[model samples]
Target: MAVRKIEHVGVMVSNMEASIAFYRDVLGLELQGTIGHPDEAIKLAFMGAPGANETQVELVEGYNGGLPAEGKVHHIAFTVDDLESEIARIEKLGVTFIDPAITTLPNGARYRFFYGPDGEWLELFEPPAK
Candidate 1:
């Protein structure tokens, strides 16, 4: 079978409220909803852009210990039309950029990384226009 698109990325968080606020209020993603799994003692919050159908960021709660030191997964990246404007908007929310400036890949794509409320790494990527 051929691979399609990414469905979602699951992130284990210590505080669901803070995670939700960072992804929704600070990052401007909409909270689709939350699911409670009593058996697993977990709560899942799905978030994405308005009108987006694929690739959601799922915030997970009810796990023990703090955020992972380093997971197999590195960071979740979102594509944006205007990286500068997006960075400015997020900066206004008090999010600091990991890089001093936007980094350009050899292929000409631009990207930047930052930490979420729970110290989860996230990225903003912009591909060169066609």
Candidate 2:
């Protein structure tokens, strides 16, 4: 059976309010809604792109169990037409970023990673060269 596109990417964060503010105010993502799961002891929010596209970032809060550095997802990269401008906009949010966009493969795609709300790693990538 063929697989469809990704529905969402779930991330566990310590703080939900801070995460929501960053994604909504800083990153400019549209806030869909947040639901609290008492059984799971967690709260989640889904953010949509400007075009009403699929939920890109799934903000999960109250996961006090913590995550391991190894065997854990490193970061999430969102594609953009102008990587530099996006980087600048995100920087204004007061988060630190690992920069110096580089090219490794022959295709030479540039990318950079920045900190999201609650210090979650987030990436921004430029479109592949055509």
Candidate 3:
């Protein structure tokens, strides 16, 4: 079966309010809404850009054992049309990215990684046009 685009990236956060603010204020993503899983003792907050498709950043809180040194998940990526322009814009917003230059994949896609508020890795990917 062919897989579709990524629906969302799950992130475990210690503080829902702070995580929500970081995504909403710092990254400028809209707060889609939040839900709680009583059985799991966790709350999920969804955030994404306005008019975006199903893609989202899912911030999770109330999890046990607190935050891990490194989350179980490595990183989450968002697709962009122009990698350079996007990097430049994000850099102006004071986001320091790890890779000084974008790395090209064998499939001709380009990518770079950066850290989120809670030290979670974030990525920007640009695939070759069809």
lDDT score for residue 13 of model 3 = 79
Per-residue lDDT for 2-121 in model 1, tens only? 123444677777788998999888889999877655336777688999888678887877754464666634457677778888888898989967778887754466768898998877
lDDT of 1: 0.73
TM per candidate comes to: 0.49, 0.47, 0.50
State the lDDT of candidate 3 residue by residue for 1-130, as single tens digits: 1123564687877788998999888999999877545335777778999878578887867655454677545458777778788788888878878767787754466778887887667788776567
RMSD of each: 13.4, 13.6, 12.1
lDDT (C-alpha, whole model) for all candidates: 0.73, 0.64, 0.73
State which candidate has the highest lDDT.
1
Q: Which 10-residue window of candidate 2 scores lowest in summed lDDT?
A: 1-10
Model 2 lDDT per residue over 2-23, tens place: 1123445666676778888888
- Give the candidate number with the greatest TM-score: 3
